[model samples]
Target: MLDLGITGVQWYARIPGTIGGAVFNNIHGGTHFISEVVKKVKVLDKDNKIRTLSGKALGLSYDKSRFHDFAEIILSVEFELFRGDAKRAKQVAFEWAKRKSLQPPRSAGCTFKNISNEDKERLDFPTTSAGYIIEHILKMSGYKIGGAKVSTSHHNFVVNDGDATAKDYTTLVKLIQKETKKKLDIDLVPEIIFLGEFWFGNVPGCQGGGVSSTPFEERVVWD
Candidate 1:
């Protein structure tokens, strides 16, 4: 935002959700993220006490922040931004949004975060694009499971075209991971979070979704 010709932040404009989620996921566009502009954040800790946390105190890093799993409520954030030309800011944000629009309209942004440098070396993978491995090598773009399909536009996006369910998404995700692991000896971790229970047979509650949850059963694969 521009205030009397001074800019507060441009990065936050790129993210879709609230500031809390942005900080939690280290939401980024362009090269910087919320962590860069955030001066401090006020969070309600598990003890129900409101406390202010500085950026460094949160240990903000690439695609991660202390708030990721901590039991706390992010009340608000304080940002410190630089003053830049209005046209330049708009151009930057436009470029970022244009890039984001290339993915599936119904899908999550990126299913898998870029591999860390250390993990990349350990896995003997040369490139950072996990999507490349899935799309180029594994050839999984447009791969489908039930109602969900990997975005042909970008391999990482999982799109729900119709009445898709969690099972469809998870099944496709597992299939990709399994294939990638078998082919490249690399284990790809997901960036998206699973909110509800994931019943994948190995888990105790999941009996191929036939135990009780009828609504969830229709979505499971080969059940």
Candidate 2:
């Protein structure tokens, strides 16, 4: 878009995924959400019919959307944007990418969503960031179980130290959830999606979704 002098959606420049994934996840960068600029969407519905949907139908809110409930595939999207300085857009995107470069390479990015602002104030926490809580409050940066360890570079990231298994990953996540809940009465909900039959045990936020009786079935364990 920057090539055409577009500016509004530059917040997504550092996000790693397709436009469809951005809308489905309602992924946010800085303080801007991808949903903010979305004007319309074209989707392949469950019936395999093409349909146009207004942006409001997306049900977008902090890492959520109606896409979680519908068996649809996003075919295309329209965004409301404005003509702006391509030079500035490039600069902004470059800065965001530079910041993201500090994250560890062996991880799937942040493991948990930050606590809601309401929850932060109600619980008497210092900040809404989950990484802050884990690193500064819980002091669990570099905390580990099996081959999975919380990244010291970023506390909310769970990085694999060479030989991690699905079991190890889930186990470490559960431990973080348990500790956060125990210490602060706050549930550390994961932002990561789990597939297959990985045992989450007593993890609070995971639930089954997507199509049933097929490969897509149980693909997203987020709720």
Candidate 3:
């Protein structure tokens, strides 16, 4: 995965997916997610035919891609990058690492996407990070759903307090999403991919009728 600082351009190495999954998810890093950086993707179809998709052909938004609807496999991806200082990139990455360290270990990543800027402004909230919303809604510490609990250190993370099942984890996720929407009028989107069977099947629902589903494409986006 690539972490491209504030500039839109990034160079990536050490990622483990065939170019297909990357294109499908628009995999990216830092404050930016996958939708912003990808330029093109080469793919191999089910019949083993090779093709290249470029520009708008690769529909990307948030952590989603149009490739999710196709059965093609990705071979490689090309990304757009900007000229930038290496030192700044490293500094930004370091900051991200520090923030990530405060989250729960062995837990799914951020449980929701922050609301849009207009929505945040409407709510008079200083920021729209899902962690911030969850912290306010759940009150963070000591919150639990079966074997899953809100991280004492961070709200967006649902930690497995040992023996946690998919049900426990998913239940907590729904609860957080529900409460956040009720209080803030903003829907939260999940960042982590759910694997295997969940308590209510893959597309789990939130209180505000929001749903989180596994991306159709099955590929690793991180190294």
Highest lDDT, which number?
2
Deviation of model 1 at 36, angstroms: 1.0
Best by TM-score: 2
Q: Model 3, which residues run further than 4 Å from truth? A: 1-22, 28-30, 197-223
Instruction: Pick out the ten consecutive residues of candidate 3 with the lowest summed lDDT.
Output: 214-223
- 1 against 2, candidate with superior TM-score: 2
The digit string of per-residue lDDT tens for model 2 on 1-223 reads 7888989877666667898889988989889898888999999998999999999999998887878777789999999988988899888888878878887888877899899999888878788889998898889888878889989988889999888887788788877888888888888878876654353322333334222333222343332
Candidate 1 off by > 4 Å: 2-12, 117-127, 199-223
Q: Candidate 3 clashing pairs? A: 9-81, 9-82, 10-81, 20-74, 26-34, 112-189, 113-189
lDDT of 1 by residue, 59-92 (tens): 7876767765466788998888777787777766
Query: What's model 1's TM-score?
Result: 0.80
In terms of TM-score, which candidate is stronger, 1 or 3? 1
Q: Which scores higher on TM-score, 2 or 3?
A: 2
TM-score of each: 0.80, 0.85, 0.72
What is the C-alpha local distance difference test score of candidate 3? 0.63
